[model samples]
Target chain A: MFYRTSGQFKTSYTADMALFPVRQDAILLAIILAFAWVILPLTASEFAFQTLLIPILIYSLAAMGLNILTGYAGQLSLGTAAFMGVGAYACYKLVTIMPWMNPVVAILLSGVFSAGVGVAFGIPSLRIKGFYLAIATLAAQFFLVWLFEKWAWLYNYNASGAIQVPTLQMFGVTVAGPTASSHVQYYVVLGIVSLMTILCINLTRGTLGRTWKATRDMDIAAELIGINLMKSKLTAFAISSYIVGVSGALFVFMWRGAAEPNLFDIPLSFRILFIAIIGGLGSILGNYLGAILIVGLPVILNTLPETFGIPISSATVEHLNIMIVGALIVFFLIIEPHGLARLWALIREKLVIWPFPH
Target chain B: MDFLNSLLVQPFADMFAAPDFLMQVLWEGLVSGILYALIALGFVLIFRSSRIFNFAQGIMVVFAALTLVGFHEMGVPAWISVILSLGVMFVLAVSIERVVLRPLVGQPDIILFMATIGITLFLIGFGELIFGGENKIMITEELGIPTGEFIFEPFGGFLLLEQKDVTAVVVAAVLVIALLAFLNKTRMGRAIRALGDDHQAALSVGISLQTIWVLVWFIAGIIALVTGIAWGARAGVSFALEVIAYKALPVLMLGGLESITGAIIGGLMIGLFEKLFEIYWGQPLLGGNTETWFAFVLALFVLLFRPQGLFGERIIERV
Candidate 1:
């Protein structure tokens, strides 16, 4: 069997500690990379790239950012959309102000602004815990959205009060704005997502991740053991915000193309939280799996009735879609509160011992 | 100097200059405060019994009102529609208890909270699919609630009070008193309080959790209907009313989650203060929509000082 580990043996501690301890995982990653990098872009249509691929990558990246704080660091934030808004608005201002700057650099740099804002809001987490802290984040959510609406300067005093992405070239290649092709945008999103995903995997597997798990499990005990609680929590916020901010920039510039302040409301935050929770919080791969399901489920449902030659209004389909998603959340939670990642792990376990009942 | 005066002195000066307008604002605040207390009371009852935050409480209001209006639209009499809506809510409570909450017993608090949000989304879709998303006018006149205005002349100044608001306050007060008596005097109410204190012990004492849960949720549903009618009367029934749920959260934070008295006092304080701040200070200095975050910000400040909230039981964590 492809997943069998019978012949593979780790001879050293380093070998055992390597990211893909099982040889099959590394090979699986290579195959996935091949599809993402080579096969999909070359074969898929513009609709597929726009509606599925690009959005999935961007959302996965955002969920990964949230997973760090809520999943790893034992902090709950319901204001992720506001942080994303900070990133998007910051990127918008950066490019508009410094038109000569590299678009990629502008997007990456936008995370710092969101990081600062994230830390400011995260201060309440030090004094509050659990749902109380979550509500504190809502204060940021509402206030920031209000700021986006009232502060004319954020949107450059645009007549419509929406941020419009302007055409920008990177090394003579159109990568963002209306003129950018879906293929180009998809690649940019894929590239940034992969880079961030690798960084997150490493950070989460290292010392900082261990510290976070300790803090999350029991902060008082973690403190007794000489862990610097403040440093751990704040660093979690800063890094989480940075990644989330970058994804926000990517969300707007690479995918949505235009956004209003209302776009970053509570519902958006809940969507991202859903991805984190449903995908299996604290797992890097879970973000992608979660994003795929959350983003792709509706699209598939929208087309299924048509493919079957059934007559259903689009509005009815939309309503059904919402109902199905809500039902699925409850179903998933009842069945596996740990999320789809755990489900995958179980399948992989069974696959490893397929021939034998044990 | 002028900026300082406008920020600090002028608002207070203006209040004294037109005492009648200030009185009207206070009256408006008290009415809204009472409504907020009603919503908070529903939350307190359910949280006390089940420890579920019930994020769906807001959507329940929308769904109940929609059901009432939908029934009337189908040619049912207004009073019958109200009764039928209560029946629908009862069915919803039983189904939710059986399908959702039963399997989720002993789950982490956040998981249960997430489940309620799931219920919220499901109801939104279900309600919209059945009744359509358009706003519907409340059957205020059909329900026999007066819609007239009362004008009071005092200090040689005119004060205006909407009769419906007066009706809302009186009805809410009566409902609260009735709810309090039911909880204190009834056997089932004591069972609910016992479950809130210690679920395992209550179960050991032969308390049927499923029955109590159904009852508690049914009561919450009834309260949701009243809130729906009162709020819908003010601003026609729509999914947009769901946003008011967020307003009750700060009240929960200020009052302890399990304390009914805390919920009522906290709700009134928030309702009154947020409006007062918005009119007197927020509009002039902060550009007016401060009502949005005012409650949350105040709650956060309160939480910083008293982490358990002003009325919540002390949190004792064990490692």
Candidate 2:
């Protein structure tokens, strides 16, 4: 069998609860990491970096942030994009005000601003739950977007009402702005995403993670068991927003290079939510898988006509692509409501028991 | 001190100084409120029946409007096109029940909600593909609705009202009356209420979930069509109408999710308050377009005080 574990007996609790309890799982991760870091960067073209690698990573991070709230902490927020806007705007202000500050550090620190906003909006969450809470988060969404438009100071009183990324360098090689190469941006994105993802895994596996799970299952029950609903919900909001904010900053800085207020609107929030849910709500790895499918879908749709010598207008392709995505969401929900992560778990289970009638 | 004076006194002074303008703003608010109520009714219907928050309701409004306009463009008579639009909505309801809702039964509410969003996206793509992305004119003249404005003179000032706006208000009033009558008098309607009240108990009494779900969705579709026409008359039929449908969510929050009366009253209240705020406070003081988040913020504060909404049943959480 591919995943044979005949002699992999654990002698201690630590061994039993290791990050990768199975030897094969660790090896598989190592192989995946090797491909991501060493192989993909060297092999990928600028188009691939922009269209696939960088976007998938950034979206995965964003989805992870949402997953922590909706999936782990059981708070549904429809306003993720606004928080992202907060991070992007905050980062813009930080770098502009203190030109000597490092771009990477500025991006990392931008999350704090969103965390504050997230906590402020999350106050209503202490009183509201379920669909009502979803609508409450939308209050945050609309108000923040309005703020973005009205509060001229957020965009620095620019006539255009858009933020443009200035050329930023780390050790004289530009890492952001038009002059920066996709490869450098990709590396910066990959490094941050990987580090944050590792941290998320550990956090979700720790005491706070269990507390969140308890709260998610039933807040009343969690409260009975001495878990402070306020703290748990608020922390989930803060951490989730923090991670989401960093991803948002990276989204504009490392990927988009320029952004308007509406760039982080509801549609973008929904797209991130799609990634998180389709990726497998509470699973870290699901974000990457979900992002790949969602991001890759459009590219594949655009190319199919050319690959097969078919004649189709780009507009028609766009319409069809939307239809397919909509249909795909329904199709996936029907096939596996638990999401792609659960599907992967099922597949892995099957793989483990292959060649035998267990 | 100056900022406080303008914030508190100036807007009220402006409203009193232009009483005619005040009447116009209130009238505008009432028309938009009726439209918001109509869309929220669509949401309330689906949510009551299946506990699925139909995010597609907005797109449904757009689709219904587009279908009507599309049919009229194809040489179909206006009234016939209206009937055809109803037929399309029925098919949409049936297919949604069969393909989407049936398989999604017993899932979490959030999952069901997500499925409806998927349905919304699909319908958007499909509608855009068939109708194209251009804004089409609603055949107001062909429908026999008047196009002239009615002016009333009182206190040496004139209040101008578009005939179409009057037609929309009258028709909406009639539709709500009919809807209320239908819900109260019909056998199928009672089944829907029963299902909403207790799912298992209703089934045990031989209520057919499939039939009831299709009926609710179709009724929601009907509401969507009516809303589309009313709104299309004012703003023209386009996908941009979908954004206005989002206004219904706050109405739903303010009125209780299941209370039909709540939806109507909440819709009207939000409509009035948002308009008044935008004109008096939001425009002169805060720069305009406060209508967008005004309803949501108002609903949020209301929720902090009354979580179940003004008319919604108190939530009884059992842990």
Enumerate the candidates' DockQ scores in order.
Answer: 0.76, 0.86
By TM-score, the best candidate is: 2
In angstroms, the error of model 2 at B315 is 0.4
How would you encode candidate 1's per-residue C-alpha lDDT over B1-319 as one tens digit per residue? Answer: 9899998899999899999988988898888877777888888899999989888988898899999989999999999999999999999999999999999998888788888988988999899899988889998999999999999987778899999999988988888899989889999989999999999999999999999999999999999999999999999999999988888888888897888888889989998899889999998888889888889899999999888788998999887
Highest DockQ scorer: 2
Off by over 4 Å in 2: none
lDDT of 1 by residue, A1-358 (tens): 6689898988999999999998888999999999999999999998998899999999999999999999999898889999999999999999999998999999999999999999998888888998888888899999899899989999999899999999999999998899899988888888888999989999999999999999998999999999999899999999999999999999999999999999999998999888999899889888999999999999999999999999999999998888889999899889988889999999999989887856
lDDT of each: 0.91, 0.92
Docking quality class, candidate 2: high
Weakest 10 consecutive residues of candidate 2 chain A by summed lDDT: A349-358
Q: Where is model 1 chain A poorest over a 10-residue stretch in terms of lDDT?
A: A349-358
Q: Kindly give the number of clashing pairs for every candidate.
A: 0, 0
> Model 2: per-residue lDDT, tens digit, A40-104?
98999989999999999999999999999999999999999999999999999999898888999
Candidate 2: residue pairs that collide: none
